[model samples]
Target chain A: MSGYFKRKEKWHKKYLQKDATLPMEIKVEEVSPQMSVIIPQGEIDMGSSGELRDVLHKTTKNKVQTIIVSLEDAGHIDSSGIATLIEALKKVEAYSGELRVVINTKKIFNVFKIANLDMVFKIYESTQDAKNA
Target chain B: MQKTLNESVYIQLSSNPKMATFLRNNVHKSCSMVGFDEEQTDMIVLAVDEAFTNIIRHGYKMDFTQRIDIRLKIHENKYFKIILQDNAPIIDKNCIKARCLDEIRPGGLGVHFLYTIMDYVEYTTINERNALIMTKHLPKKSRTKRLSSVNQQLLQTLLDIGRYVHQILDLDTLLNVIVNEVKNLIQCESVSVLLEDRETKELFFHTVLDENKEVANKLRGLRFDSNKGFAGKAFASGEPLLVRDVEHNPEHYNKIDEDTGAKTSSLLYSPLKVQKRVIGLLGVKNKISGSFSEQDVEAVTAIASTVALSIDNAYAHETLQQTIPDLSETNRIRKEIESARLMHQATLPQALPSIPQLDISAVCQPATEVGGDYYDFIRLNENNHAFAVGDVSGHGLEAGMMVSMARSCLYTQVNFSNSISDVMTAMNRMVCGSIDKNLMMTFLFAVFNTQTKVMAFANAGHPYPCYYQAKSDTWQLIKDGEFPLGIHEEFQYSTHRIQFDKGDFVVLYSDGILEASDENKEHYGLERLLKLLGSKKWMNAQEIQLAMLRDVRNFCESLFHDDLTILVIHFL
Candidate 1:
C-alpha cells in the first residue's frame, strides 16, 4: 500500500507547475516488473543535481535490474549535472545492472559531446528506442 | 549687393525642438535673399536644423532652459558663414563619428550632410563654450565653377580620415591608415611620420609609405638627432618648412637618401603640436604632379594636429590595459591571507577553563592577517589544570600551521603525563621529527594543583614567567630553561616547583610585548613590564591582565608590528 501511494505522489508532482522556475521534475514508471524508467524535465544545473543524485542512489540501493533516464524536455545541463550522471552510471555498473540515457534536444546532447561523455554512456535517440534495447 | 554682403543676423533662443523649425525658416529666408536657388536654400536649412537638434539633444541632454546663440553673416559676396555657440559640456571631437552607410542604419546622417555641403566645418571649445563654425563658398559662373567638385573631394577625404582615426585604437593599424590617406590626399610621392623620443630628444621614423614597398621598409625605424636634419629642424623650431629644392637646403640629412637609394627633390615638413607642445614631425616628399605648394603645406598642417591628439589617446589606453592584471594579482593574494587568518583563529581555545580556587584570563592579538602566537588551557584531571603559551619563529601561513601542530601535540602529551618536564620532552621530540627543519617554537608549560597550592613549571627557551607575592610586594622572573623545541630533541628539561598562597599569581607572555617599539625606536623592555605588574599585583586576574595590555599599547602608541599573547593565572 505504501508503494502504491509513493507512485501516485511522483506522478502528481510531474504534471503540476509545468511553467514554474523549478530546477527539474522527475517521473518514475515501471516498464517491467524488474526495470523502471525515470524521466526528468527542465534545466539540470547545480541547484538540482543533488535531487538527481538521491534518486539514483535509492534506485541502485533497491537493486533494480535496469534503469533508463529520459531527458526529452531537458533544455540545459551544466558540468555539475553531468558529473552526477557519471557517478550514478558507475555505481550501477559495479553491480550487474545497466543504465541508459535518452536525450532529444540538441542543446542537451551537445553538452555530453563536448565533455566526451557520449562514448561512455549508453545513449538512445528516444525513450521508445531505449525501452526496446 | 554690398548691403546684403555686410548684413548680420543674430537669434537668441532656448533649446527646444519647436524652436528648430523657426530657426530653419529664418535661414531659408536669408539664403533666398542672397540669390541661392530653391534646392540650395533647402540644403542649407536642413543642415542648420540638424546642428541645432544636436546641440540641444547631445550637448544639453534635452534641457530646454539652456540658451543657444545663432549668428549668420555673409562675407564679401563670396562666402556664407554661420556660427552656433552654446554653454554645455565640451564634446570630444575625436569620438564624434558618422555610422557606416553599408550597415543600413537609420541614424547618424546629420554630421555627414554638414561635411558634404559646407566647404569648412570646425568645432572648438573656447572659454567653456562650444562654437561650431561652418562656411559655404558662393557658387560663381566661370572657371571657379569647375574647381568646386575638386574642393568638395578634398573635404570628403579629410572627413574620411578623421572618422578612421576614431575607429581604430591599435597604434600600428592607425599609423598605416594615416600615412596612406595623407599620401592620396596631397598627391605626394611619399609620406612619413617621425615620433620624438622624450628621453633622448631624438626623432625616429615610426611609419613610412612610398610607391615602392622596398624603399618604405628601408626608411622605417631610421633615427636622427632632432637638431640635425630638415625634419628635425621643423620639429625643433616648432614651425613648418616647405623646401622646393633639397640641394640648396643646408638642413637636409643626405644620409637617409644614401641608405635608401631614393632621390629627394622637394620636401614639406610640419611640426605636430598639441596644446603648444611639439610631439613629432609630419613630412611629405616629392609631389607627383608639381612641387609642394602653399596650399599643400596648409592642408598637411591641419592633418598633423589631428594625428597628434589621436596618438596621445592610444598611448593612454595601452597603459591602462597593462595595469589590470597587476591589480587582480594583488587582490588574489589579499584573499588568501584572509583565509589563512580564519583557519588560525579556529585552532584557538574557544573559552578559558574555570577551575576551583583559580582565576585565569588569556588573550592573543595578531598584527597581520595571520600570526604565530598561541595559548591554551586544558583540564588534565579533576584536581589538575594545565596551561601553556608559545611563540613560533615567524609569521604568516607556514607559522600559523606550525602553531596548530604544536597545539595538537601539546594536548596529546598532557593527557598521558602529569609531570611538566615529561610533557615538554615528548612535545620536543614530536616537533623535531615532524616539522620543517628551519621552524622553531618556544613554549612554557605549567600544571597547577588546586588542593595543595603547588605549581610545577617547565620552560623551553621562552620569556620567563613573572611570579608576584602579595605579602612581600616583590616581582621575580624565572629564566632557567632548556633550548626551544625543534632545535634539540635529546636535551633534558628541568621542572621547578613553587608554593603559592592566597592573592599570589603568575604572568606568562610572548616576546612581542617586550620588543614593541615607540615612535622614538625605544623598546618597552622588561624593566617597565615588571614595574607595571608589581603595582597591579593586588588586583584580580582579569584586571591585572587588562592593565598590562593597556600600558604596552599606550607606550607604543598602538603601533604593533608583532603578534602579542598574554596569560595570567591567579590562586585564590
Candidate 2:
C-alpha cells in the first residue's frame, strides 16, 4: 500500500479498538469514482453506527454515486444502524444516487417492516446487484 | 346494579327430552318466581341449556362424575344474578389468540355461539374448581334501540332462548359481528361456549344459552381418552366430528341428553386448541333437525375460533396477573447482576496511565458472581511508592463487598499516614471490627523509598508475594504475613523491610490467577506459571505483566473459566 493508504489503514485500525485493542473493523476502499464499499468484519451494533455514518458521509461527500454498504463479515445490527442506513438512503435519494446494501435477511428485513419502509426502496437479492447497477 | 347476596344452588342433569322441556319451563318459572318477564325467562332458559349441554357432552361425557353448581339470587335491586362454578382446566389467552381459525374449516363454533348469547360471560378456576358467571337484564326497557333485522330475530331468540351472537358476551352488548355474520352462515337453536382446561383436560359450559349460566362441579377436570365424547374424541384425534343424533350415535355423550332431559337430534364437536394444545371444545347441538352444511360448520367454526381465542385470552389475562410477581423477580435479579458488573468495572482505572520511570501494572478477576481481590497504588513522596493488595475471605458479592470496604478504609487514612506497617495494622483492625464472625480480609501493604531503594511492608493473613531478581536470575516467594484478617481483636501484623536495586520485579496475584482453567478443565498450574515467568526476557513491569497474561490466555483457549488477576511492579 502507498503511504497515504497505509496511514488511512492505520488510522482506521487505531480509531476502532476499545481501550487499545481495535475491535474487528471493516475495510473501506475508495477504489474508484463510482464505487466505495464499507465491509464490516465484526459485530455492528449502535456503537458501530456512528463510524458507519461517518464513512458514508465521507464517501457521499466525495461524490460517490453508487455506494455499497457491505456486511460480508458484519455480525449484527441494532435499531440505530437500521435507522442510519435509512437516513443514508434518504441522503442518496436527495442526490439521485444509488445506495446498495448487502446484509443478512433477519437483520434488515425485520427492521424495514417494523419501520414500514420496506416498499420505499428498490431492494436487490445481493450486494453484487447494487455494484453491477 | 351490585348483587352480593349469598345463594348457592347445585344441579346434575340427564339428557332426556322431557327433562329438557322441564328445564325450559322451569327457567321461566324461576324467572317469574323472581317476577321476571318472558324476555327474562328466555335469557335464563337459553343460558341454562347452553350450560347443561356443555357439561353433559364435554364435562361428564354421558357419565355423571361431576355436578354443576349454580349460585342464583334476586339481589336487593331486583336484578337476577347467577354464578356457575365448575372444576375444569384453565387455558392461557395469549396461546389462544396465537391460533389461525379463519381457515376453511374451524374448530371453535360453540365458544363463538356462547359468546354471542350471554350478556356477560366469565370463567374462573380457583384452587382446582372452575366457575362460569353469566348475567342478563330482566327488563325489556334495558334492550338496545334501532336493531337490525338479524339482531331483531336474535333478540326474539333472547325472549325464548336467552341470547345469540348479537348480545352473546352479555346479552346486553354487540355480538353484531357474530350475529349478522351467522344469520347468513349457520343454523341452530342457540350457540354456546365451553371453556377448556389446558392443564387438567376438562371442558365446561362457560357461556350457556346466551345468558343464563350453569356450572359443573364434579364435571370440571374430567379427563378423556382422546376419543371419548364427540367433543373429547375430536379434541384428542385433532379432527372435527359430526353427529346427526345424540341418541342414535354411539359416540354422543348421553349425559348431556339425559341431564338436560332433552334428546339432542344432532351434535357437532371440535377442539378449540390454540398453539397446538387443546384449550377447550366448541360444539353445536340439534342443528335445526336438518343436514348440517359445510358452510354451517365453516361459519360456526369461524365464530367459534374467534370466540375460543377470546376465551383463551381472557383466561391468560387472569393467569398473567397471578404470575407477574414471579416474572418481575427474575428480571430484578438479572438487572442486579448487570449493574454489579458495571460497578466492578467502574472501580478499575479505565487506562491505568503509564507512571514515569517506574514500571507498574495490575489486574483483578474473580471466580464467580463477584470478585474479592483488590490492589491499590498511591503516589507517596516523589521518590517513594505506597501500595496495598488485599484478598477478602470467601467469594462473590460478600467478598467483593468487603474489598470495597477495605479500599474505602485504606483510602481515608493513607493521606494522613506515612508508615506502611501502621496503615496495614489499621486496615486489619478495621476489617476485623467491621466484619462479623464469618467475613474478613487478608491484606499486604508496603511503602517503597526510591532514594534509599528500601521497601518496607506489613502483611495480614494473606499469602506471600513472589519477587524475581534479575541479578541472580532467580525467583523467591516471600512469606511475610500473619493469619487471616478477622480472627483476633488486636491481631499483630508483621512488617518486613528489604533493599532492592534496579531490574527486580515483584508479582502479586489472587490465587484465582494461578488456578485458572481451560476448556479441558485443566488448571494453568503454578509450576507452569513460574516456568513461564522464568522464561520471559523482559525486565519491565509492563512487559512482564503483558507476557504473563498472554501465556495465561494461550493456556485458556476456547474455554477460559474463573477470574485471573495479576499485578507486576519492577524497580527502574
**Maximum-TM-score candidate:** 2
| DockQ values per model | 0.00, 0.01
**Candidate 2's residue-wise lDDT over B1-572, tens digit each?**
11111222222223321123334433544454444555445545555655654554455553322344444544444345666554444534233221122331222323433344456666655445655666665454323232334333322322212112111222111232233233323456444445444344455554333211122222323344433577777677756677765677676766754555454677666666443345556666656647676645644554455444443332332233233343456556644653454355344443343444456776555543566777777776587767777777776666667777787788877887756656766776777777456787767788877788778888776556778877898988877767777778676666798777788888877666667777577788777767877775664564565456546755663234336567788878
lDDT of 1 by residue, B116-215 (tens): 5578888886446788888887756421443244343444344434433433433454666677668867888899998776657778888898876678
- Report how far residue B473 has shifted in candidate 2, in Å: 1.3
Q: How close is candidate 2 to the true structure, as a TM-score?
A: 0.38
User: Against the native chain B, what TM-score does each candidate's chain B reach?
Assistant: 0.43, 0.41
The TM-score of predicted model 1 comes to: 0.36
Worst 10 residues of 2 chain B by lDDT: B163-172
lDDT of 1 at B373: 86
Q: Say which docking band candidate 2 falls in.
A: incorrect
Q: What TM-score would you report for chain A in candidate 2?
A: 0.71
